[model samples]
Target: MTPVSAPPIATASITGLVLAGGRGQRMGGADKGLQMLHGKPLAAHVLARLAPQVGVLSISANRNGDAYAALGAPWRAGVLADTLPGFPGPLAGLLAGLRAAQTEWLLTAPCDSPWLPADLAERLTHAALSARADIVTATTTNAAGEVSLHPVFALVRTSLADDLAAFLCAGERKVRAWYARHTAAEVAFADERAFYNINSLQELAELERA
Candidate 1:
């Protein structure tokens, strides 16, 4: 598919946050973001693909802040998962990133998805702005041809940080639970492989060979 041109939204008002704070239990507890994919760590690939899509780029990592900083991004900033306790999932990363982000919008992408599309931010921003929605997430078709939401691959309004903090404080962890309270828009992509994330060594190896 042909890539879309950059949308009319100001790039400086949006920040890209790479979600690298996962526990990675499926990969034998290895840092999934740091795992090698085609001789480059997964985070590096993600950063390379996402950096140009925003004005600033930062990483939300629970560990190895130094390594993620070394991913060759000159405009990089690092935010530790400190908003909530006990690795409270991707929302914690999102909260911490929201606190650190200077932009009005925050775009999040998983560090494990090395082949993320180049027009992700542009498309999401376009969709959100058109619908006047607070959250815009990426959706892709599965093998059965059914479209599904990928919450981690989302563009959110940073103004909802306090609402998110309250939600987490109430012990709610499911992303959809919080999503239900907001007006969200989904921008679907035709290529299912674009949303495929590596959760295990076998999947990583298969992606490498593919």
Candidate 2:
């Protein structure tokens, strides 16, 4: 896959946040982020990429603190922030991250997706800045160039937390639904394999081999 140049990644604009709060139901209800990918925990691999890109590294873990705390990064517990109808999910974690971020930009990736690109945070931030976007997300394609979107891989403004929280209160829970109301850029990863989230034990097994 050909890499597109992400607009200039000014180090001043972004803070990294890893969303780790999901209740991992598919992998037998275990903490999927805590599961080992190789020699290290899944979240650890994400932390390696995350801590380097932003001035601060924050983990959004809902129910487990010691489990996630041992990773040694600053952690924030996700609240039942979604006042929206049907129990809004990881958006709760995203809301927590945006609240904790002090920087102008917040770059986020799901904890279960450990193989996210090294320049992910930087690239997403650049994509947003370059397009004068409200938010920026990662996209990738297969050999045929069919685009796939990964909304969890995003760079957003800290200022949007209120809007997002308000959206939740208004009974809008889906991330894509809220994102549709804003200007967003999809920075293609150009490689579909790069953004897969290990939501199931089957995928975790595959990641171990990768």
Candidate 3:
């Protein structure tokens, strides 16, 4: 796919949901989203991209509302119980985001992806609508020619809460597996670097260097 700008869409009509909770074991056990990058929290970068595009929004986190709350966006705690016992994962978080979402369209993204394109929400929404799909995923490339989807960076119908809730209850935690159960498209990123996900301290350090 050729790289292109993310022209705006119906920002006043959709909802933005930030996934802010993670075990962060890779960063030596801290809230990865709260980690400071350039003296600012990573969550700050996510909120900035999300706030201008959606009319309503919330953060889906676990264990620490106070810090998540300070971002000044309403927050939804991860419903660990919402997923099948012993299979807790991002599906549970998405369930919570979908439940709390108040718009027809819901945009979900993680807090640690700092360099996401400015028009991510709009482009994802556009892809979703054009495909006539229930969901649209953002995929980016790597130097090894591997293209991966940021499952968190998806545009879904808020009404799918029931479908998502049912999926989470079936002992399914893998996002791609759950996403496969629907008619979805992988929207390739023209600039693969934008889909980078920071999972470890070393990765974050490398990102800082870049």
Candidate 4:
């Protein structure tokens, strides 16, 4: 009898989701994902990095769906809108991702973080599987020994969709708070720059100059 080999991690059981549903108030209300970054949209950069790490891909955007849809075209990524209205928050985007993903796990990163680490999904999935956790989030330590949790960069089980939806319905918008209620693990990353997110136009300009 011939033995079969498992599929590569890139086409295994994970789906990548880029969170771009924010109001972008800090960017002067501009669509941050649509913003130009090195001649391409910011979300495009995120998708390019994330698409190869998962079996499927998606984008969470509240407005300008057409533009986001265009950015997702190369990957055949689904563009999801918040089922709940009023531009709630990233949690809303997460909920949409959890529901839309066809894979057992969903890996997420903010669209603004164009420099997100390429190993994000691999590391998080390894941690989650090893710890048998429902969620795995990325964390970074500063020179001063301060640990910062980047909750937006996370891997979650699709089975938690119901629980997340309930939490959102209870008016809970806090990502860490919701995470605390689940079996969560934190994976430390050495490169903090990989997680740096541009919040303002000035920051974008500075990064561009860099």
Each model's Cα RMSD: 1.5, 3.6, 3.7, 4.5
TM-score top scorer = 1
Tens digit per residue, CA lDDT, model 3, 116-206: 7777776787777788878888887788988776788888887888988777666667888888888898788878767667788787777
Ranking by lDDT: 1, 4, 2, 3
Q: What's the C-alpha lDDT at position 192 in model 1?
A: 76
lDDT of 4 by residue, 1-210 (tens): 443233234456888889999999999999999988788989999988787787878999999998888875667558999999999999999999999888888889999999898778777877887898999999999999999999999998899999999999999999999999999999999999999998999988887787
**What's the ranking of the predictions by TM-score, best on top?**
1, 4, 2, 3
Over 85-154, each residue of candidate 1 has an lDDT whose tens digit, in order, gives 6888999898998889988999999999988988898899899989999999988887898878899999
Give the poorly placed runs of model 2, Cα more than 4 Å off: 1-9, 73-87
Query: Ten-residue segment with the worst summed lDDT in candidate 1?
Result: 77-86
The lDDT, on a scale of 0 to 1, for candidate 1 is 0.88
Runs with alpha carbons beyond 4 Å of true place in candidate 4: 1-10
The Cα RMSD of model 2 versus the native structure comes to 3.6
Candidate 2 residue-wise lDDT, 25-107, digit = tens: 88898877788888888888888767666676777776566777778635332222322333357677778778867778888
- lDDT of every model, 2 decimals: 0.88, 0.74, 0.73, 0.88
lDDT of 3 at 100: 66
The C-alpha stretches of model 3 lying farther than 4 A from their native spots are: 1-9, 73-87, 206-210
The candidate, 3 or 4, that scores higher on TM-score is 4
Residue 94 alpha-carbon offset, candidate 2, angstroms: 1.1
**Cα-based TM-score, every candidate:** 0.95, 0.86, 0.85, 0.93
